[model samples]
Target: DNEIKKIKAEYVRSFLFENKLMPSTWIVIRIDGCHFHRFSEVHEFEKPNDRQALNLMNSCAVAVLEEFKDIVFSYGVSDEYSFVLSKDSKFYQRQASQIVSVIVSFFSSAYVMKWKDFFPFKELKYPPSFDGRAVCYPSTEILQDYLAWRQVDCHINNQYNTCFWMLVKSGKSKSEAQSYLKGTQTREKNELLIRQFNIDYNTLPIMFLRGSSIFRIKGEDSVMPENGTFEEVKQEIILSHSNIIEDSFWKEHPSILC
Candidate 1:
């Protein structure tokens, strides 16, 4: 038994570096689809934004939250998703590599598992994979900033893709569309959408611009004395397609972090 234990410990030693997350800090795991541009084309994703793909992504995110209760909030847009764990969490011993790896693996599996629900008639052309990384933030404000960064990126990329595709749909080749959008600022992009394409950029879906976030809320069935009583807590995960940069969101869901 002693020899067996020693050999088993050696087998597990290689994984020591993979799952370690910073102690007493918030853990954020972000996963991105690998080479999804070609994947989107092959799957016939709608231009501007694909609602089906977005739904699939959101579903996967929800699945992650369900599997990892410590993950209090999640945000996703386009081909990427970010999961935020509580600062006091001890999941997977708070290993960065373990947390990131499992989230990415589970997310990818969920995506593939639920693809049929989103695209029943459309078969998966090939296996889809995702890459992930874990980042630590000492403050909640910084975590909020990370979310804001992703939302800003979503707006920028969606705007650019919308313009590029609209131009292509109007008979311009891919190269021509790229050239036309080159060096164009945000104002220029908006003008192009309105003047040429007759699109109301402001009227686009908020989900396309700001992405989606899942906030988990816990409600107890009965009240208990804080002095010594115990209460049952039921968790509810709420999905929101709203701007998370403002203080209103944070204020509304104060218990998420604690």
Candidate 2:
């Protein structure tokens, strides 16, 4: 019994030490497409294609690296671009803001240039100015705000769904209930929903249901389950195959659903 106690204590201590020593300083950089105006006339070059979009995204990455060569450690671009640093560098954050600022400026200027090149004199209407003012170098908060704004502004036509569950006693259409639940209008709102409600673009309907349970349990009973974390619940929802959770599977297939 004494030897068993010593082994268990040693195992616990080692686990704690390993968890404590894990690095939390790494920086994750995500770069995705910004906004694009509809072409007045569908030129072969003007129409957005995966190949063209990828090329443009690559160009943006190159532009960022060229402007801030000293700060970037390593970067990659696929569907979206990302950079990972061994550790967070304040310099890189500063440079990221600068790069984003330049990209925004270039986007604005390029819009005008492309309009002139394509239309010449056909009374081209420029898209509305991104409500936010342009900056030479932006702060992280500003960059995040701008990115969020751009996302909503760019994808205005896309539909988002919110889910709701009421007790069997309540009589309301799920759609009507979900409408009252509210869709997020901003990136901050979405992030908060993901963190608090455990729902996001990638979350399945079943996952949403599990999240709903956890959310309700916490809200009403102040109780959490011992067997699962929020993420585990989310994963379980994804793995399950119930017809009632069809919406969840559809959420993961945006392109097909869209």
Best by TM-score: 1
What's model 1's TM-score?
0.90
- Report the C-alpha displacement of residue 85, candidate 2, in angstroms: 5.2
Best by lDDT: 1
| True-vs-predicted CA distance for residue 1, candidate 1, Å | 11
Candidate 2 C-alpha lDDT tens digits along 10-111: 988886421111132433344443333333222223221223433433444444444443322222222233333223344424344443445445544444
TM of each candidate vs. truth: 0.90, 0.26
List the candidate 1 regions with Cα displacement exceeding 4 Å. 1-19, 220-231
Model 2 C-alpha lDDT versus the unseen true structure: 0.35
Query: Candidate 1 vs. truth: CA RMSD?
Result: 2.9
Task: Kindly give the stretch of ten consecutive residues in candidate 2 with the minimal lDDT sum.
Answer: 209-218
Global lDDT of each candidate? 0.89, 0.35
